[model samples]
Target: MTHIRKAVFPVAGLGTRFLPATKSVPKELLPLVDRPLIQYAVDEARAAGIEEFIFVSAPGKTALEDYFCAHAALERQLADKGKTDLIERLAPTRMPEAALTIIRQDMPRGLGHAVSLARRLVGDEPFAVLLPDDVIRAPKAALAQMVQAHARTGGHMVATMQVPRAQVSAYGILDCDEDAARGRLLRARGLVEKPRPECAPSTQAVIGRYILMPDIFDRLERQGPGAGGEIQLTDAINADVETVGVTGYAFDGERFDCGSIQGFVEATLAFALDRPELAAGLRARIDRLAGNDRFAA
Candidate 1:
């Protein structure tokens, strides 16, 4: 099996849900805690041995590109102040020269179109696709787990989670059978894009992480508008089921859907509570707020 080297990040969405805040700022640049949402995804891809990073972005999202570049003035200021620790913390944000590539999507077609834009950069090798909106908290990065599984299975793989049955329509549902030999690995028969609750094949919902073969680009190139009148990535993957075979790896992690306001706040509080410096004060504040009569149920 060929080792995965490149990863594509589709960051072209308008982020309408965020309204005023996303008006000028790309959603991926929004801070999850101390770091931006895209930072976590980049760190996760690096951990999984990805060497080349491709960002499929739209117009007005140049901030995403700037975020990964070194700020020389700021660095010099920090060095002048002898803040070595601060400099070390900033090192991870800079992408190595030529390792990062930005491609313009030019339109808001859909996930399939965005990923297809990276075909030339990805070439014929199997590559990973990571959606920054899904911030997964895990002992092992989610993409790394999928990479390990991909090494053994050597086909298309996707990170999956069992969402509530009622919520199946919000995600691409998988028709799969649990692999008896390997726990948590599901052998996919097909995929349904946001099927109604009663029509869903299973509760196994496809998440944002994927390790897919390059042949998928061909499918996406020919695919028509699906579901919400856009070129759905699920449709292209579904087209490969009979020929390529797809596997679902239920990753061991707590995924925070940062695409929504509620999930963003939940992730912020959760990450803040994890930091020793902020936890105590945050906990006290939470206690006070909960006890206040103004917040009474």
Candidate 2:
């Protein structure tokens, strides 16, 4: 089995949803509690054993690149203050310094186009693609689980979760049969890009994590615009499954769709309430909301 060594992160999109907040700052840099969104994605990739990081960024993302850069001054200042623990916590976020490579996506072509920009950097090897906007928090990171599934099955692996029948229209739905061995696992026969609720093949929707084979580059290269005039990753993945087999791993994780306003708020509350340090405060706040007398009927 080919071990996936590289991962592509598409950070080129203009975060229009977040508006003024994301105007000066990239959406990937949005803070989730204490850590930046991109940090969570990078940490997840590292846990999945990815050695090389290829980020597809745009003009205003120098700050994003700088965030991962070594902070010699900060380290020295921490050392002077005897803040050894703080320095240690940040040290892992710095990858050998050279492991990270950035590519500029000249335009907001699409997710597939952003990934295609990393082909030269990825160099014909299997690579993982993670959408930082969809942060999944669990005991075992979602990407790590996908990699393990990739090792088991030589083909591509897509992380999936159960979506309500009415909500299937919002995601890239999958067509599959129940795995004989694993109840959650599915043998993905095909993928449909945001099918209508009535037209969706199955309720199993593909999430943001994917372990793709190099053949996807070719598909993306020739793939036409679907939802918009931009090349979609769903088209490429679906193309591969049409010719070859693809597998879906029911990820054992809780996903926070930070792409939208409601989802981001929910993610914030979930993450904050789960922390032992802040659970009490969060509970108190929730209790106040529940018992507020202002809205009583």
All models: lDDT? 0.91, 0.86
Clashing pairs in 2: none
**Angstrom error at residue 39, model 2:** 0.7
lDDT of 1: 0.91
Q: Residue 113 deviation, candidate 2, in Å?
A: 0.6
Best by lDDT: 1
Model 1 alpha-carbon drift over 4 Å, by segment: 179-181
Residues 205-289 of candidate 2: C-alpha lDDT, one tens digit per residue: 8989988888888888888887789889888888788565688889998998898988888988888888999999889887887
Poorest 10 consecutive residues by lDDT, candidate 2? 176-185
lDDT of 1 by residue, 18-100 (tens): 98999999999899888999999999999999999999999889999999999999999999999989999999899999999
